[model samples]
Target: MEKILVVDDDLGIQKQLKWSFAGYEVIFAEDRASAIAQLRRFEPKVVTLDLGLPPDPANATEGMATLEEILELAPQTKVIVVTGNNDKKNALRAINLGAYDFYQKPIDSDTIQILVSRAMNLFNLEMENRHLAAVAPSMDKIIGQSESILAASRKAERIAQTDISTLLLGESGTGKEVFARSIHEHSLRKDKAFVAINCASIPENLLESELFGYEKGAFTGANKTTPGKIETAQNGTLFLDEIGDMPIGLQAKMLRFLQERVIERVGGRSEIPVDIRVICATHRDIPGMVAEQTFREDLYYRIGEISILIPPLRERNNDVVLLARTFLAQYNEEFKTKIKGFSEGAIKAMSQHKWPGNIRELQNKLKSAVIMAEGTHIQAEDLNLTFNNDALSIDTLNLREVREHAESRAIRNAYQIAERNMSRTAELLGVTRPTLYSLIDKYHMDDIKTG
Candidate 1:
């Protein structure tokens, strides 16, 4: 049976609660010390804490202290503070200090039982969710179950054991570097250094020296001979992030290095051989850049020998929730806060938001929410996502408009789920090919491409 700890100094209230909670192994404690001892011994999931103890039965100091201590010991424990009928102030204070819920004196047997039952239910639900999250589907170091992510991961896995140049294509903040590291970690050179450099972050003037190193007195600031990123990863992998941002001048040098597996440092004469695998990532359309003459086609083809496209968070279906839960658990442990989970509205908002910034945005919002959230559960407001109102406004009550909106949404979703295959989309939507095309034209969704 589940244990319920009732901390009350009054004999009458203690006897009343014991009889009131006959279905459980009820434990009683008269003071803070006894209450903590009973809490440690029983480890009850639910506890009814009275604000009046022997040390200061008339005030709330001892009771408040006990509540803090209980939560500090076990943040998961649901402690319902019991205050006098007029002590709602202290009750609210206890809640801010992390008490699960609060109750008032002269408690009705039915009301108190309902409160305890609700807390127990929430506790069990959170525990189950935690266990489920622990075993959530993952690919190597990646956390996702969407077909888009899985497809990308499978491609990465297949080419990891090879030395082929890889290009990771994704939107900004879509964890491109993570894919790069995962590939290197799974490669033959896992034990060797995995160097990463952002082409966009480095200046055009210094980029060449950064990538190819420099000899002593190569420039005014070149104090000594130093190895470039490519040379440093002699037997390992070099991740050139935002490779599309690399200058046209540098592209030729980079191409030569890739072709010869050798480099000549700035102001140096001898060609230095460096056997390193190259992995490049960019959020830009390198093909478009090549067509526009802004990027070198030869370099693009060289680095993109094997390309993997990582889908944005918005298109990953329910993977957003999985990622959010993972981040919540991580931040919870990092901050030493026991946030049970996200509120229903928060989850709904997260699912609805487009997540334009992808995993990085979600991570930032979740970290801030974890630290700033006042309640046990993170709310929609904490994440800065608007909680959608279920109530239909007068403007949205028109049947024809609502039908059109729903149909458009359904068609788009079906088209995506069917991987943009017209016949498959029609079959999924239970519509003829002509009808699907008509709907797509009606919605003006011709630009929707499979990313």
Candidate 2:
């Protein structure tokens, strides 16, 4: 039989629950310490914790601490918090702290048993889903189980065997180059070189020569015949990062090369035939640029024959914690530190944070946290995130109302975090001061003192 750990100070309640849970082997603990001990020993799938424990039976301080410790040690365990009548506030707090669910006291054995049964079913379902996701084919470098990322990975896998020109679109730091390299590695040209160049980083005057090569004495500094990225990637793949930033003048030449599979070196008349696959990536709006006449429409169509949009980290649910744990292990080994895991506050703060910079931002934060963290577990403070227990309440089903609620909550949280400083709050929310003020007025939040 599966095990259930019951933590309560009252013998009557424990005895009643013991009788209530008939099919499961139940373990009892009257205090926080013994409860954790039982938890480590049995590794129960579910735990029912009372918010009133010994040495602080009247208050929930010890109970809250117990909840945090339990989650810290066994984050996958489904913890159901039991609270007194009129103690819904503490129950909600427990939920925010990662508890599975809560129950109010004057316990009905039948009702509590029903709740426990549901929790067990949900836990089993989650474990099965995790097992399935783990078994799914995944990219070696891409670490994510979210559908958005997995879909993108599947698309990449399907296209990896082909030599078609591909385009990857995503926000900066979303690892477009990583996908490009993965495709190259999976292709028939795996043994060949994979050359990468950033169009935006190279100067306009030098980019043409860099992509198409320069002949001997092509320019003042052209001392010898040197192959450019295109030639260097012969029989392999060329990753042109920030392709949207390629100048319109250069786009025509790139278009010619793509159409004919040949190129002319700088100051050289002979057209050089090249055999290479091209993968382009950018965070800019290429179609918009084409419309504005800053980029050629033909070049746009050529490079974007097959395009994939990679989702930002914010859109990936639960992947934040998963990726954080993976990075924590890596950083721990690299830094030679034994940092165990994230604190409950850190986990909550990470889930709530809007990761504007995507995976790169998370990686940077974890690296620093690993090196600088004081305790065994990394806290929200270590990651520079606020440990705000009050979460946004989603009480409505309307889409517009949900967006409005999110906007208002984000504005309020940023404003408070910024100490009512208008500029700082606007910066935090990634909006202008005028827009911030307009939102505050629209939300009837003029009561917020702005400095």
Best candidate per TM-score, number? 2
TM per prediction: 0.61, 0.62
Candidate 1 per-residue lDDT, tens place, 1-451, comes to: 9899999988899999998888889999999999999999999999999998878999999998999899999899999888776676787688778887776656667557766876887688678756755764223578787899988988888888899999999999999999999989988998999999999998999999999999999899889999999989989999999999999988999999999988999999999999889999999999999999999999999999989999999999889988998899899899998776776557767988999999999999999999998766787888999855352345567664455556656776887899888789889999666455544433334334312
Clash count per candidate:
0, 0
- Residue 310's lDDT in candidate 2: 93
lDDT of 2 at 84: 78
Q: Show the colliding residue pairs in model 2.
A: none
lDDT by residue (tens digit), candidate 2, 1-451: 9899999999999999999999999999999999999999999999999999989999899999999999999998989898876676787688778887777767767557766886798788679867866775336677777999889989998888888889999999888998999888888898999999999999999999999999999889899998899999999999999998998889999999999999999989999999999999999988888889998988889988899999999999888998998899899889998776776557878988999999899999999989988765787888888756556445547654455557767887898899889999999999766556545533434345543
TM-score of candidate 2 on Cα atoms, chains taken together: 0.62
Off by over 4 Å in 1: 1-138, 391-451
Query: What lDDT does the true structure give each of the candidates?
Result: 0.84, 0.85
